[model samples]
Target: MKWVLPSLLFSLFFFFLNCTDVDYNEKSVNRTSRKILIDASHDGGVWWSPQSGTYSASLPHQGKLMADFLRSYGFTVDELPSFSVITDSILQQYDKVIRAGCFGTYQPSELQAYVNYTNRPTSLFLIGEYLNPAQIDQLAENLGIHFQGIYYGNLDTYAPHIITDSATSFYYNAGSIIVNAGTNPAIIPLGWLDGDNNKPSLGILQHPFSKILFIGDINGIESLPQPLTLKIFKWLFG
Candidate 1:
């Protein structure tokens, strides 16, 4: 009876030690509750815009890599119908939007819907590129940010911001940005391309309600490290 009782105690202790506590939670980006919408190009996905046959970006895979990266984390990502018009209801459902203006035409109402979305505390990642500046402008104009011409590359130049410490140098072909005066005064310029007159390659808007990380290079998004990308998203969502 004495041996039997000791054996039972030992078995119980081993079971408790070996069992995994599935109930415990790890500290991570609180992004699982936030929903993301990828509304890029005129098509279904973000991969359609800002492309040149391996020549445009540092290494061109377009938006697919970014979309995959975001999803690799637990964030919920969705695509609007390529032909679908953006509306208040749709935008409201998403915590953030990832946009690459390549060939999409935003109706006046859709732009207004975005205005409504941003009027609240919403965030966005606006992708930029050298090609189709006009098309990119259509979506960005609503936010009073404009994407301009090209710059070959930059070794590294960063503003004092959260994502700056996450990466060493930006390695992609990027475009320039001209942020308007009256808009998000909390503008923090992120990176620059040094080839043509120190053109700015990235901009971040850190307003209380409207958080935007405007990436001026389509290929730049493709080249971003996952930790850096998550940090950028966390900042935007925060």
Candidate 2:
């Protein structure tokens, strides 16, 4: 009986170890197989041309850089030039959606569709720049956030977040300010401009099964280090 009890204890220990290993391996596989969608449509405003009426038929460098970064971490990335291609069926295929520098007005149905998608297991990263107040307000209302269309500049530094470094001095050509709307528990601030009375430069809304990360400026991603970028991806993807 003494030997039997010792043997049973040993077996239980080994079983627990095996279960832990399986869980870790499963999480690693999920991260490796994760797919991301980068939306460069809606006048991303990441690239500019000095010559009048000259446009390049190329994806925005910001989107390309972000895609490349995510790809390096074993993530599959898809770049879309227009949100029109996104449907409920299509949105289900991606684990995350990143809309960088978006300034286009969305229809009510389109906004509702996106809201529905966020309510699922899918995550979203909304990057904005220089949008009109009305457009910002509309988006804020739809997403249960408070966004003001005001450019913040001449800033010596910024608040740190999952992606931003505390020591980094940040400046934006045109950046919006976000505040807590108090409508939902999911909506919360992630980062903010320095010395702006805690006005959020980056916000996150954690829905029931999904999440949304909002950045006031897309340029912030361009300046982030690879380590910080990876951290951001981990936060968004996980």
Candidate 3:
């Protein structure tokens, strides 16, 4: 958790850039009662320390800011310390879910539980890392999407969707791209890596009663433009 001057300053630049999104929290507070579960159970590092809200000012603390953003929007944010079975008792509680990382394998019933949950009107957001993505890909495969490739820097393409409106200039510390696996009617590309529509940096899977948005980047959440992040939450829980 230590930092040198130049490297610290560089990270700080993106930190403040992302922190500016904290204002979006004030923009809309107590707006709705939508509930969200940030599945940090798999040892996901995308969320904050809970103890350190957005005030920590460190780059990683930006995850805390994301939680604050949700709170400001009047959504109840919950954390899952384990990805065991994802029983209906737990899945039924939240209107939306965001899974940012996974270190271990997922239970077969858990994947089926998610599939069952999506049979209703719900939304799920997935963030992928450039490093080991076996577990992430496994879950994604069950959901009809795939994460592939590895790279760092700008995503290089965008869609006309509201989500992409605020993510025009998204640059990442590191990330991956979603592979184009045949033609799944339910899947739509939200953003691409270098103008290749087949490979996406951001994609969404449309289910009968649910939608799953996948971000092919580890730092995608923390590094996402504030406006873009705000729009995504609003669209998901709003």
- What C-alpha lDDT values do all the predictions have? 0.63, 0.62, 0.67
Total backbone collisions, model 1? 0
In candidate 3, what are the lDDT values of residues 39-140, reduced to their tens digit? 755534444444332223233353666666666666777766544346767887776898766546677777777777788878888776664544356677
lDDT of 1 by residue, 62-172 (tens): 565766666656566675434567888888888788876545567888889878887887778887656443555666766767666655665366666777665566566
Candidate 2 has its poorest 10 consecutive residues by lDDT at 47-56
Rank all candidate structures by their TM-score, best first, as comma-separated numbers: 3, 2, 1
Clash pairs detected, candidate 2: none
TM per prediction: 0.70, 0.72, 0.74
Q: Which candidate wins on TM-score?
A: 3
Identify the leading candidate in terms of lDDT: 3
Regions more than 4 Å wrong, model 2: 1-29, 47-60, 82-85, 137-140, 153-169, 181-185, 225-227
Where does candidate 1 stray beyond 4 Å? 1-27, 43-46, 49-61, 81-83, 102-104, 131-136, 179-186, 195-198
* TM-score, model 2 to reference: 0.72
For model 2, residues 131-235, the per-residue Cα lDDT tens digits are: 674666445458776666777663343445654554344565577777664556776665556666556666677667776777767665656544545555667
Task: Name model 3 segments beyond 4 Å from true.
Answer: 1-32, 43-62, 82-85, 131-136, 196-198
Query: Model 3 residue 236 lDDT?
Result: 70
